[model samples]
Target chain A: MASVYIPTPLRKFTNNTAKVEIQASNVDEVLSNLVSQFPDMKKHLYTSDGKIPSFINIFVDDEDIRNLQEGATDLSDRSVVSIVPAIAGGVDFSKEELARYNRHIIIPEFGMEAQRKLKASKVLVIGSGGLGSPMLLYLAAAGIGTIGIVDFDVVDDSNLQRQVLYGVKEVGTPKVESAKKRLTELNPHITIKTYNEMFTSANALDIVKEYDIVADGTDNFQTRYLVNDACVLLGKPNVYASIFQFEGQVSVFNYLDENGERGPNYRDLYAYPPPPGLVPSCAEGGVLGVLPGIIGSIQALEVIKVASGVGDVLSGRFFTFDALTFQTRTLNFRKNPNNPISGEKPTITGLIDYEEFCGLKAEKQVKEITADELHQWMIEGRDFQLIDVREPYEYDIVNIGAELIPLSDLPYETDKISKDKKVVVHCKMGGRSKKGIMELEAKFGFDNLYNLKGGVIEYVSNYDPEASIY
Target chain B: MPVSNVSPDCKEVRFEIASRDFLVAERLAEKDNLELTGIYHTHLIDSAYPSETDRMSAFPNFSYLIISLPNLRFSEMRFWRLNSNNQFEEEVFEILN
Candidate 1:
């Protein structure tokens, strides 16, 4: 007698019984008897070609039955034929989707399989900024099955310059909500999930693990590094891009090759970050308005290629572009032996303080005061100086009766700031004011500066909804 | 299966069992020469009568027993099933000695 032990997955077919003793002398007889007792188990145990598939391993007495003479393997009275389903369907596209992707299907190299793979892919885009705007537009247009957007910033008139995902109506609204509204209007078929929160170390892994791949559109170096480490640790490919004044760089990081070997990651290219103030941000060093659109489209193409095995993914190759001279270059880079994440002797295990690693002082370097707190202070007749570090045009639109000293003119007008009193500085939103505080503290050695948290936008949104907000 | 309060409705909760688990339950029932006939649940705020949501989400041809606990001192039990027109029709019951 041979005992067939059914795993949990196939137990339903066996009337929820774990083991069934069969009167069989060989491996084939044991399987046939088990299937005979439960007729539904035949298709689960055998392929259409009447052969056992590789995924389902058949073992007898801790030995592979295939190691013996296949079906003729002898089974003793004490033999246990274990049917184990180890740890770990047709999604046909609608007629409209088929028509939309007819161009892709027409290509012999890029056919229905690639289209299906694309429709099954779930890509998480980190930021809804300049790059995110164009990339998400194309992603939705192409009908990626699921797209996740992570952004916390509210839309402003400044974003309309390059952030094609929003309009005047979306101003003062969360970027994710705005992007979702725009992308949905573009293609209602694909699913778009919004994370109206910062993608920090605490929630980075939680969010990235849900998506099949990540297309990083984050602007800051802190988030760029965070995206890289999360993708590497999760063994997911990162479709990466970064844009400067008129130049942009694109590369696919931590990608697995056909042989299941990992390609060079972000650390392999630039092992360490440049000093905090060394590389100015896109906000400070303006991006050529159309640079992200061009680069972001390329990024979307790489993401689609990675999701669907259609063409050669830009995994090992780094592409750079300069709009001034219209120059384009593609260079090859390899894994660095000195890399900390993936090296002969690895050091870092999990995500660490990216701000400190980038040589920026950990956050809270600049003291901040919220609008509600400031309003309470004003009501109590608290003695404090409020400085508006915004352009005169913005101050003209609306102001909380603070002296206007544009950021460009802050250095020349430092004498106007009160040294004895606690100084609260603010701009359109909290970002520029934070930079203004950091600049004054570093250059002029002023210690009494406090950035107005969320700046005028928060003040108007929560405290004074009637007030005009940029 | 026990119910949870994750759903939007605070007054009621239903265990949305997976089809796989339902299939397993059916198979287990068949092994003992029985069948899955019905489900019973509780309503905290409303009476034992079926709510509109309950009728819309109900599976056909199964007796549904709803026990209402409107207050700490009183309790009521009623039986129901969906008719051919997909309306909840109350079923009369008897107590055995």
Candidate 2:
């Protein structure tokens, strides 16, 4: 006798009973006995052709019947037969899709079936920047059914170095919009969903819930943590990739294996975010233009592998690429015993303010004014010393008539700063200016200091568009 | 129509029941000249609310009844309707003795 576990939706057929013990030697006999006891459930479980609907899945114990012999799967006397209905999306390839995926169709492992799976899978990309450019392009080209892009940044001339998705003509266009347009041109068979907004905790879960997989190409730790947590909660695989300078890393996080066990998640590798300012962004720390191209392409490959269920994914393994040294390494990692999610129940069930978690949203320690405000103050002849905390090379590229005193030399150059008058600090972006102010106030005890918001780029964009500096 | 047991699958969400039992119930209802009113299911762990999977599989015109069995013991039951926005909205119902 095998015990057939009735799913919640089918329990009514068994007089609201949760489980029914029936005499059966195999899956077919078990299902037959169940139907003999309750007939109406037959239509929902099997079609008129006496075949199980595509939406229905039967599992003998922990293994799916499809993985075994559908109805002829031998069942033990104590085997628990579970009948489950399929979730939302299923593969249905059109004629054009079949033609478009003909190359994949002939492959031994990735045939028409895998191509159909690819067409059914939905992937969400967290950024449309350097890594995102190649990721979105390759994903769309591979015939992924749906692709969602989250980006709030506009195309900048500086992005032309590595972000191949956008050209100089799109310098001021929104990244998501430009990415959609470019990806559409690449593969019109796929659907491209654009989210021209920041990926924040408030919208991460809502947006991530609709996708089957999340590809993290974000350049910041805050968004990376947010994507990782959201994927873990939703039980979605997160194909993650990060590139800095000439180095890149790729891994698949929070993936469930055939044994019903989850692989090591992002928290396993990084228990906590690095301290703010310790890791400079690509904007502050320049990267090789081709670094993201290599990393993001690998991310796309991982996404396809996970989606099509073709090759062994990078789950539980960390892969690194060093373009400078031309060396690659793959390291294996197990589920951390101390991980919060390693237990039966996860401690972190929802997304948190990642910026705050990463310590990027520290309390304001310095007064700041926007570029427009500074421009007005300058026009009014405000007596303030404009100090540029950026490096000398950056100063040579662009300057707003502010005296250069690089952040590294700020301690020694305290006397160069005005002590009597109000002092204004500006850097490439506003980050270094805030740091400069804090250092100046801590060491030199300068009380009257205001950091220019949006830094030099903002000022150049708004006040002086002719400035040929990034 | 009513749904009874929900078995967890390693991959994908699936719902199942015996078709013979449901057909017999439908025939009995037809003999009584009673139209099929709704479908019912049980929730063993979570609240007696329709999940996202339920919303996706819901029939808009039919009532969705969810019985709560917190620890495999009968608890409470609620009726839901599929609203226009494709969300499940609980409906007020009276249980006759």
Candidate 3:
């Protein structure tokens, strides 16, 4: 008796069995016994001519039957007969391409067909910041044929930690240019097209039209909504992933299923963006260094799957990760009836001014004083309360005689702030202090607050350049 | 749920062959001075075909029997045996008066 070992993908026809024994003395008889036992498998195991396809190799105890006596190869008692099928091949991947992506190609779930599709697809990435930074690196490494990067801002020294795509040398350079250079160094086969401009309504449609898919990594709400609407209008799939502090979210929108029925868009999930400053930006909230590495990599994976036509994508569903608790959840969603772009009775025909749409139109300018003015105030010995709204950790690093009242503790401890005195509130770079001052004006009605223009950094830079920042 | 699931018009039904139940049955068979032979289950909306799920739960050498009650068609009862190589083969059985 010879034991035939059946591989997966064919197990459904074998009654979900892994091994089947046959009372056969030769390879030919063993196959006959197999098909007789599992009649449904005969169609899959053989060609239309009743002959085994060349892709299926029959082996008798580590020896192929073709290398032995062909089908007449005698099988010893208890011999293990294995039937192996070609998982991926047939000019589906080029010689060099296969060598580079051999590990990815071997996965039966993401085989050569998907690899070929990946090599033929183009994806546009918006804002190569935190989410875009890591996502672009993986996409370029994964062999996406062409990638378009759209960003008008230059790189800053602060982006080096989590934005793994940029190095210390790339600071003060255009993000799109640095990103393209770094990506090409990783894989030269794929083309990297850089659009050194804002992905606004003007160029959004034109740039998005060139790519089959768009990856939304923009940090601001206006651009996030802009990218979502543009992809919807262009009939392109948008892969959105955002990280805030220790938490991150990923979703696929405007994606078409097999039947051409489009999935939900961003508006379906949230018809309107949260009022400005309701959700603190990554710049203000601060993120764990490794959080984007995990979230953005998943974003990269989704783009590969969505573009290459493999794996179940995150369409019509939202996936979230909480690094603090190390928990992940996927919430399934559907199209909304009020989605302005894809829903019933569409209102937005094309891209409009997203600033007004996000309620950032009525900009409120807080009172401010520059570092030079503050120095003159110190020279004249101005009597004012210098309140440092930054955290104690930052205050401990460097402080010039300002009482530390961290913004987090301000809501509960607002009584400590003097309303009678002239208040000069300041933060590390004035953003947080501005927010603290706004909270004071809104809730406490203390209109005596004035934000330091460049905050402590500028004050330190103007007087003492040797004052090192922690 | 039997109360209200009817999209397919097939009247859905779920089945489970718990391990604890099997263990209790094995002990009962041992106490009765009988050998544990096989197991059986009813398929309310299916035929007497050996499903992959059914075959996977059976012992390699034990017999399996399915009693199907497909309401529209006549009820059927068939016997099966899981061979040494884990493959299933039908075994003949007859009802007697």
TM-score against truth, every candidate? 0.51, 0.51, 0.49
lDDT of 3 by residue, A41-129 (tens): 79667889888775466877767777799789998897988775432111333346657887776676776557767888999999898
CA lDDT scores, all candidates in order: 0.82, 0.82, 0.80
Models sorted by TM-score, best on top: 1, 2, 3
Q: Write the per-residue lDDT of candidate 2 for residues A345-442, one digit (tens) a residue.
A: 55776777788888978576798888989999999998888989998888999999999888889999888888899888999989988988988888
lDDT by residue for model 1 (A27-114), tens: 8888888888899888778888978764466777666677777788998899987764321101145556767887876576876567
Better of 2 and 3 by TM-score: 2
Higher-scoring candidate on lDDT, 1 or 3: 1
**Which sections of candidate 3 miss by over 4 Å?**
A1-94, A363-470, B1-97
lDDT of 2: 0.82
Docking class for candidate 1: incorrect
Looking at model 1 chain A, which ten-residue stretch has the lowest summed lDDT? A84-93
**The CA-based lDDT of model 1 is what?**
0.82
**Sequence-dependent TM-score of model 2:** 0.51
If the candidates were sorted by their DockQ against the true structure, best first, what order would they fall in? 2, 3, 1
lDDT for each residue of candidate 1 in B1-80, tens digit (9 for 90 to 100) = 44333322222233343333443454475589765566666655345777555675565556778786654435799998
Q: Which candidate leads the pack in DockQ?
A: 2
> What are the RMSD figures for all models against the true structure?
25.0, 20.4, 25.1
